[model samples]
Target: MATVRVGEVEVGRVQVGGGVQIAYARVGHGPPLVLVHGAGLDGRMWQPQLAGLADEFTVVAWDEPGAGRSSDLPAGFGLVDFAHCLGAVIEALRLGPAHVSGLSWGGTVALELYRHRPELVRTLILADTYAGWKGSLPPEEVAARAEGAKRMLAVPREKFDPTLPGLFAGDPPAAFVPLLGTMAHDVRPETMGAQLLMMAEADQRDLLPAITVPTLLLWGEFDARSPLSVAHAFQDAIAHTELVVLPGAGHVSNLETPERFNRAVREFCRAHA
Candidate 1:
């Protein structure tokens, strides 16, 4: 259980299960707010939220298995495996019934957590995410994404580029570029492949209507990956959902518009708390 300091945050690793260690960065003290990052990224992506929201919430961002300081993606790992691992992290830290927030592929994991362990989630904050490619996207798009993932997996680590064109409506933010590049460079082929494949095949539309807790849908106005239409679909499907679109933002809204994003999350969590 080694730990280090990332500014005011305590970055550490915990053994969840199967001898796997999950890395997490925790800060502040209040209601627990666990953040899950998107594919090809890690907890570092949530640095803004960890720093901004800490004054009001105990923010914790995890580097999911195969992503950051965490262990490799074990064989036969699926979406449920990710959810179970997240549940284990919350339990290990005794942060159950927490406000679980996820972005992109991480959103899918949050939904899975709610489906399998509803008691562990107090409210859900999903941003620039999908219900899974199959669930929210057209068949053609899903097929294309699956093919792209396959192609990406074949690229050598040195040649791999984690930059997705639509991630930002304009250029990548100046302050985040270095951090983003570093994370992109560190992306593992095996982990990216598994996450992409799982996303391409997932369909969580069936679980949407069954959600009982409050769900805040924070979307980027220009989110090319998961567009506004997808956000509408989520708003319509989930019984208790509120949609807030961040203007002038793209797929990674939190990074593009941290102030607005943080405000939305803080208000939502406080209301629910």
Candidate 2:
């Protein structure tokens, strides 16, 4: 295993499925809490949660396949592929029945993991994510969303400063903005593009009922990406779930308002664990 310091936290790496190296870190020492970042982010995205939760539980943040410091994707890289990769990581690390949390696209993958390998998950946390395209806009709307994503990706890394305001849904702390930039620039654009396409085509509406694990849905009050309606739908559809909206928070509430996010998550895990 290799270690690198991102700010005050020490991150580590491990080789997993497909012989791909997956990055992860462990801190504290209770029930396992596995953290998964969104589409354009790596394991480092959970700095706030890691700092807060690590005092109590085993906080684990890792890079998804084809993103961050992890190895490249194997053939047929899709949501299923990524979810299986998560399962593989759990088995490889022997962290069974772990409390899993994910944001945006990562949330979708977490749900997929519960659906495909329910026995491996102890609890579920979904933030700023959606179930399917049913309530989502039609093809034209999706195309527009894709176009906007393209524009964001098209901006040259040098010109695309992370210090800009409104980088996420709600404005994050000034100290946190640079990290967002680092994550944005560190991401491989092609991998982001492929994952965005995968997200757009994914539909898990039918599979929601299959997830019986206790779930927590965290939504930013003004998340333009997933929207509040998506959170409501997920809460209503899932048999065992609770919805918590972060006031004045945006898409990346965990980063923008770590205290609120961490508190809610910690309470939920303690109550359910």
Candidate 3:
């Protein structure tokens, strides 16, 4: 067993390609556990997990290109390009066949990574994500989400207000709501547009059954975005999958119910390790 020094959160930059450097926050020391955050969020979204689970795993949460401290998206970049960037992050960090976890769009990104390079990923933990809105959600909901993403870019930076209330099931902790606000303020509108476009076109429904790695699905019991039905779909499609529903949690269960989320992941990794 290994443990990390409980101190400051370590941050670094990795150049994915085209002079663009992606940012990541790492903590702990052990087998690598890479966290990919959802759309409109940076690696900061995984701060709770990093803070709690650092003792057992080398947990790293990454900012996607165009989010957090990462560089802007280059010309002609698409979903596959994002997948390759994840591979680059793993390589640059020297994680060595890590356990990968993703939330919301990040989960789709994880699937893309699997599609591009299956061997690099040892296990996958997908939370609050869809195969693609088209792949999993109803057509009407997909269009609505697409429209919402488009409208989000129209929001001015000064007026950038993150919808924190929707992320939790009921009243969230006093601490978390403000954190969401700060993260929302840090979001780059230009990069958000690219992510929105990616969401509109991404479709990983066909890839579900092909996933060969041990997979876990963490669903917020009250998740309105990627609801329980989506988890059912994932379990029905994928092999060697396990699902856990976080009680009293909404879209961002890992943050809303941090202790439960952390415990689930640690036990799963320990079993696999």
Candidate 4:
């Protein structure tokens, strides 16, 4: 139960199973809004959301087991493990029935959380995310992505670059580059390898049709990783889903177009709250 303040956000750690300390950043005061960031990134990636949406909602973003200040990713960790860890965070924070939101790989974990612990989620906000590589991408594409991840992990730690092209429509906003670079530089290869493998193997399509809560699918207009077609698939499968595409954004819509992304999330969560 340790906490420290960085500007307005209170960063803290909670012990989950296996004695792993999951770090999280929380701010504001309103309906609980939990953010799950993509692989290779941590809760700090949601700084824009924590700051922008704070006035409207209580925003909490977590560093999953392998990322940020959290403990290492234990061997044999799987998607279900990620979901259960998330469930523990929500429960430990007394944020059950929260507006659960995730981006990219994080979104897949959110779906798994819903599958195992629906009582913890009030609404779903999936941004530029997939059902899973196995579920959303063609077989060949999945294999290629897995191989790419393996290659990335083989790079020397000093030379590893976590930035993926097409994250933004063009260049990422200049103001965000420093923070993005810092996070990229801090990425641990072992953690990344485990997380990417989980992403590669995950398949949550069967759970999509079962999602009963209201879902907001926010996508970047030119998302190369998980394009609009994947968003459409989610919209079709999730019964009560509404899709909102950020006109000029790409894969990382939340960061590439924070204003539009936050606006859509604020509106949707308020309605559901």
Choose 1 or 2, whichever is better by lDDT. 1
Give per-model TM-scores: 0.98, 0.89, 0.93, 0.97
Tens-digit per-residue lDDT, 1-273, candidate 2: 567766656577777656878878666678989998887788888988888998888888889888887887776778887888898878776787999999987888887898789899999999887663333446675676566666766888665432222336645668787887788788776677767777767778888877888999998888877788888888878899989999988888898778999999999999888
Runs in model 3 deviating more than 4 A are: 1-6, 160-165
Cα lDDT tens digits, model 1, 1-273, are 678996888888988778888999999999999999999999999989988999999999999999898999888989999999999989888898999999999999999999999999999999999999999999999999999989988888888876666899899999999999899889988998899899999999999999989999999999999999999999999999999999999999999999999999999999999
Error of 1 at 150 (Å): 0.6
lDDT of 1: 0.93
Residue-level error in angstroms, candidate 3, position 208: 0.6
**For model 3, how does the per-residue alpha-carbon lDDT over 191-253 read when each residue is reduced to its tens digit?**
777776678777789999999889999999999888899999999999999999999899988
lDDT at position 78, candidate 4:
86
The per-residue C-alpha lDDT of model 2 at residue 273 equals: 84
> Which structure among the candidates has the greatest lDDT?
1
- Local error of candidate 1 at residue 265 (angstroms): 0.3
Model 2 scores worst on lDDT over the 10 consecutive residues at: 158-167
In angstroms, how far off is 70's CA in candidate 2? 0.9
Where model 2 places Cα greater than 4 Å from the true spot, the runs are 1-10, 132-138, 149-167
RMSD of 4: 1.0
Write candidate 4's Cα lDDT for 1-273 as tens digits: 688998888889999889989999999989999999998899989988998999978899999998999999887888899999999999988888899999998999899999999999999999999988999998998999899888988988887877766778898889899999889878888988887877888888899999999999999999999988999999889999999999989998898999999999999997888
Positional deviation of 101 in candidate 4, in angstroms? 0.6
What is the Å distance of residue 186 in model 4 from its true position?
Answer: 0.7
Candidate order (lDDT): 1, 4, 3, 2
